[model samples]
Target: MPRLVLEARRIALTVQHGLHGRRRAGSGENFWQYRRFIDGEPANRVDWRRSARDDHLYVREREWEAAHTVWIWPDLSPSMDYASRGQAPKRERALIIAFALAELLVKGGERVGMPEMMRPSANRRIAERMAESVVLAPRLPASLPPPFAPSPLSEIVLLGDFWSPASEVAERIELLAASGAQGHLVQIVDPAEETFPFSGRIEFREPESGDRLTVGRAESWRADYDLKLVEHRARIRAAAERLGWSFTVHRTDRPASELLLALHMRMGAGGTASAAPKGGGRAFVSRGPA
Candidate 1:
C-alpha cells in the first residue's frame, strides 16, 4: 500500500509539470487578468493604480477558486487482477490511477473522495489518506460503487474494465446521472484483451464466475471477438452520451499520463468532455455539458 501511494504521487508530480495554466476570472484572491472597466460598473471595482498607467480605467479579476467535489472509484473486482505477459495487473493500475488522480485534483483546488469509502476532502495528503482507507477497510469495495445521488454540484469518475452486462452498466449509469452530476467513465483494458494474440488451443476463464471455455483454435474467434468488443464499447459510450457524460478508453500498454492529461483538461473545462484525437490505442469522447 505504501509503495502504491509513493508511485501514485510520483506519477501525479510528473503530470503536474506538464499541465498548462488554467486560470480564469472569478472571485478568488489570486489575480487572474485585468480588463478595461465598463461604464456601467461601479467605480469601486476599478483598480486605480492600473488606471493611472493607461487612459482607460481597468478592473482586476481573480481566478475562480471555488472548490468542487469530485468522487472517484476504481473497480477492484477479481477481473481487475488479471494481467497478460507479466504486465502490471489491472487492479494495480486502477488503484494507481485513482490515487494519482486524487492527488492532482486536490492540488488543483478540488475536493476528492471515494464513494462509500472516503468523504470529500481537500487535504494535501489525499492520496496517502485514500490508500490507508482502502487498506483498513473490512472488505474490499464492490465492483460498482453504491448507487446514490451525489450533490448536483459534484462530479463522479468511475475507473474499471466495465465488462459487466450492457443492461446492468446502462442501468447503473442512469441511476447515477439522475442527480444531474457530471460523470466520467474510464475503461481500463489490457492489451491482450484488445488484440487476442493467442493462436493455439487455450482455455479462457471468467474471472468472477470461475467459468471456463476451452477453444481448439483461439485465433478463429478474433474477428467475432473484435466486433463484439467494439459493439460493447459503443453501448457504453452511448449510455454516457445520453446523460451528457464522458467516456474514455485506455489500454494498459499506454502511458497513464495521457489519460490523466485528458481528464484534467475535461474537468478544467467545466466538466465538458470534448472529442480527443485517437492515438496509441486510446480513444476519448466527451459530450456536451448537462
Candidate 2:
C-alpha cells in the first residue's frame, strides 16, 4: 500500500512537468486573452493598457477563474483485484491513477471527490483524505457505480476493468450523461487479459462469481478470444461516444504516466474522449498493452 502511494505521487509529479505539452488549463490566475468591452459592463474591469493600443475599449479576461468538481471512482469489484505475474492488481493500479489524478486536479485549483468515499474539496488535504478513505472503505459488488445524479456540468472519471456487459455499462453512463455531466472512462486491464498467452491445460475462474472453466488446450481459443475482445472494445467505445464521453485503455504492464498525461490534457481542455491527445505508448494499441 505504501509503495502504491509513493508510486502515485511520483507519477503525479512526472505528469505535472509535462502538463505544458497539453492545452493550458483555465483555472489559473494568469491572463488568458483580451476581448472587446461590452455595454453595461463595469468600466473598472477594462484593461486600459491594452485598450490604449486598440481603438475600442477592451477587457482582460483572466483565464476562467472557476474551480470545477471532478468525481473519481476506482472500481472495487472482485474483477479489479486480478493481477498477472509481476504486475500490479487492476484495482491498485486504478486507485493509483485516480489518486494521482486527484493530486493534479487539486493542484490546478479543482475540487475532487471519490463519490461516497470523500467529499469534493480543493483543500490541500483532499489527496490525503482520498488515500486514507480508499484504504478503509468497504468493498461493494463489482457492478456499475450506484445510481446518483451528478451536479450539472461536473466531470466524472471512472477507472476500472469495465468487464461488465457492454449494454449495462452503456446504460449507467447514459444515466450519468443525462444528468448533464461529462465523463472519461479509463479501462484498465491486465496484459494477460489483453493477449491470451495461455497454452495447454488452462483453468479460468470468474473472480466475481467464483465460476471456473478448464480448457485442455487454451491456445486453440486464442484467435476467437482476440476477435471477441476487439468487438467488445468497439461496443464499449461506441457507448462512450454516444454521450460524447471519452474512453481510453491502459494495461498493468505499462507505465501509467502516459495515460495520465492524456487524461489530464483531455479534462483540462474540456474535450471528449476521442479528442484527447494521443501518441505516447501507442494509445489504443491492439492486442498489446495500451
Candidate 3:
C-alpha cells in the first residue's frame, strides 16, 4: 500500500507540472480582479481603498472557491487481477490511476471520493486516504460500482476493464447519467487482450466464472476476437456519447501519466474530449445527439 501511494504521488506530481492554468471567477476568498462598480449595486460591495486611488468606484471579485465533488470508482473484481506476462495487473493499474487522479483533483480545489467506500473531501492527502480505504475494505469492490445518482454539480470517473456484457455496461452508464452529472469511462486494457498471440493448444479461463475453454489453435480465432472487441467498445462508446460523457481506453503497458493527463484535461473542459496522446489509444468525447 505504501509503495502504491508513493507511485501515485509521483505520477500526480508529474502531471501537475504539465497542467495549464484553470482559474475561474466565482465566490472565493482569494481576490481575482476588480471592475468598475455598476449602478444600483450594493455600496458595501465596492472596494473603497481601490476606488480612492482611481477616479471610478471599483468592486472586487474573487476567484471561484466552490469545490466540486468528484466520485471515483476503481474496479477490483477478480477479472481485474489478470495480467499478461511482464505487465502490471489490471487491478494495480486501476488503483494507481484512481489514486493519482484523486490527488490531482484535490489540488485543483475539488472534493474527491470513492462511490461507496469514501466521502468527498478536499484533504491534501487524498491519495493516501483512498489507499487506506481500499486496504481496509471488507471485501473486494465489484466490477461495476453500485447504482447511484450524484448531484448535477458533481462528476464521476470509473476505471476498469469494463468486460461486462454490453447491455449491462450501458445500463450502468445510463443510470449514472440520469442525474445530469457528467461522467468519464476509462477502460483499462491488457496487451494480450488486444493482440491474441497464443498459438497451438491453449486453455482460456474466465476470471469471474472460473469457466475454462481449451482451444486446439488459439491463433485461428484472432480475427474474430479482434472484431468482437472493436464492436463491444463501439457499443460502450455509443452509450457514453448518448449521455455526453467521455470514454477513454488505456493499455496497462502505457504510462499512467498519459491517462491522467487526458482525464484531467477532459474534466477541466467540462467533459469535452481533448486531443489524444502520441501513443496508440482512443479518447472519445460527445456532446449528446445532434
Candidate 3 lDDT tens digits, 1-290 = 78888998999999999686456678878677899999999999999999999899999998676646899999988888878899988889999999999888877767888877888887889988999888888866676788986888889999988888777889998999898889999888777766666899988887766777888997887766666666777888888888888888788888999899888888845564523223433221010101
Tens digits of per-residue lDDT, candidate 2, 79-165, equal 888777898788888888988898888777677888777778766655577888877878664456766778875899998877777
Between 1 and 2, whose TM-score is larger? 1
Q: Candidate 3: worst 10 consecutive residues by lDDT? A: 281-290
lDDT of 1 at 158: 90
**lDDT score, candidate 1, position 143:** 61
Q: In order, what lDDT does every prediction score? A: 0.77, 0.75, 0.80
Please provide TM-scores, in order, for all candidate models, with all chains considered together: 0.80, 0.79, 0.83
TM-score of 3: 0.83
lDDT of model 1 at position 125: 95
In model 2, state the lDDT of residue 168.
82
Query: What does the lDDT come to for candidate 2?
Result: 0.75
Question: Comparing candidate 1 with candidate 3, which one achieves the higher lDDT?
Answer: 3
Model 1 lDDT, residue 156, Cα? 88
